[model samples]
Target: MKKLTLILICIASLGLASCKKDTIVQSANNLTIIKYIEANQWQSSADGFTLSASLSDNRIDDRTFEDDGILVYISRNDGNFYEQLPFVYDVQSYSYTVSKGRIDIDIQSSDFQSAIPDKPTTRTRVKIVLIESSQ
Candidate 1:
């Protein structure tokens, strides 16, 4: 009886040890802007315009593009929602990156020229949304 009780106690201990729950840490930040930038004229040429945003306490430099991701959204008005844009980090394209507390964005006018025609007299408004996440 003593040996059986000892074995049962050992088994219970092992079961309890194996039942330990895993602790997972997760955090996320979302940023939204209505008409972050407005331009008197919309151009359709490369390097015609540039836009940027600064995010504080985002720890962006520590995140890898693969493991972590940055999501971007843009719209011409404040009401309609647009699909998320694919983020690119390259030399020759509309690209963006985050480091420390600042997010640097380069927008190519030619990419959106069709959507936004080159109209000198018309006013253009742009809205942006940025999402950051970590685990």
Candidate 2:
């Protein structure tokens, strides 16, 4: 009986050791964005807006990584929407607009990579920014 128990314990320990540790795969698929600041002038004279976005690089293969793009759809307080592409060659882009009395900016990632090439299951991080312009 003791021998049987000892063998089972050893087997369990070996099984645990053989299991691979969880690691975050970094990838170019991760996007990053910069945040914008609101200016005081934007309050009265003109409405201004700025924003940026990108994907996170953790859990993705840099080799298979491709340039992630960003698309922004902005909606003003007055119920007007505008679309803009803010990524160029895997880099972040900035957008700005000024009007009479309202500013709105929204940003999101526009591209993705296939996870099957590297492994069965993969994870990634995405980011977005909302900016209210001041100038």
Candidate 3:
């Protein structure tokens, strides 16, 4: 009888531990940057591009960006991107490179963090832009 009671207690403890919620927010990493077409002209200007794509849990897909810093990674052959001056909240500019078709905006929760006004305690939203180089 004592052994049975002890086993039940252990089981309950395990259940409670497993029930702990994960608070770590995640963001997108893999992004497919599409070119904007207007008047038969591809709008690839610096000011013409926008990273208005929505992110889930601060993640883009498989990419992670930095807040107030620069992150560079390879998405594909000559299809890499870079994000700079990102924030946990508010509208910020993150840049990337595109060659063949479209650019991708990859973001990860691990890339952003709170600074200056104290580390943010909640998830944040970020904006990005695609820039095609003439080089």
Q: Which candidate number maximizes TM-score? A: 1
Candidate 2 on 1-135: residue-level lDDT in tens? Answer: 999999999999999999998888544433334323332212211221222222232322332223222333422222333334333223222243322222233222223332111110212122233332222
TM-score, every prediction:
0.35, 0.27, 0.19
Candidate 1 lDDT at 97 equals: 59
C-alpha local distance difference test of each model: 0.46, 0.33, 0.34
lDDT of 2: 0.33
If the candidates were sorted by their lDDT against the true structure, best first, what order would they fall in? 1, 3, 2
Residue 36 in candidate 1, Cα distance off native in Å? 3.7
CA deviation > 4 Å runs, candidate 2: 28-40, 45-135
- Stretches off by above 4 angstroms in model 1 are 1-18, 28-30, 37-39, 46-70, 87-135
lDDT of 3 by residue, 32-120 (tens): 33222122221233443332222223332223332222233322212344223432323223434422323344222333342112222
TM-score of 2: 0.27
Better of 1 and 3 by TM-score: 1
Better of 2 and 3 by TM-score: 2
Order of candidate numbers by TM-score, starting with the best: 1, 2, 3
List clashing residue pairs in candidate 1.
none
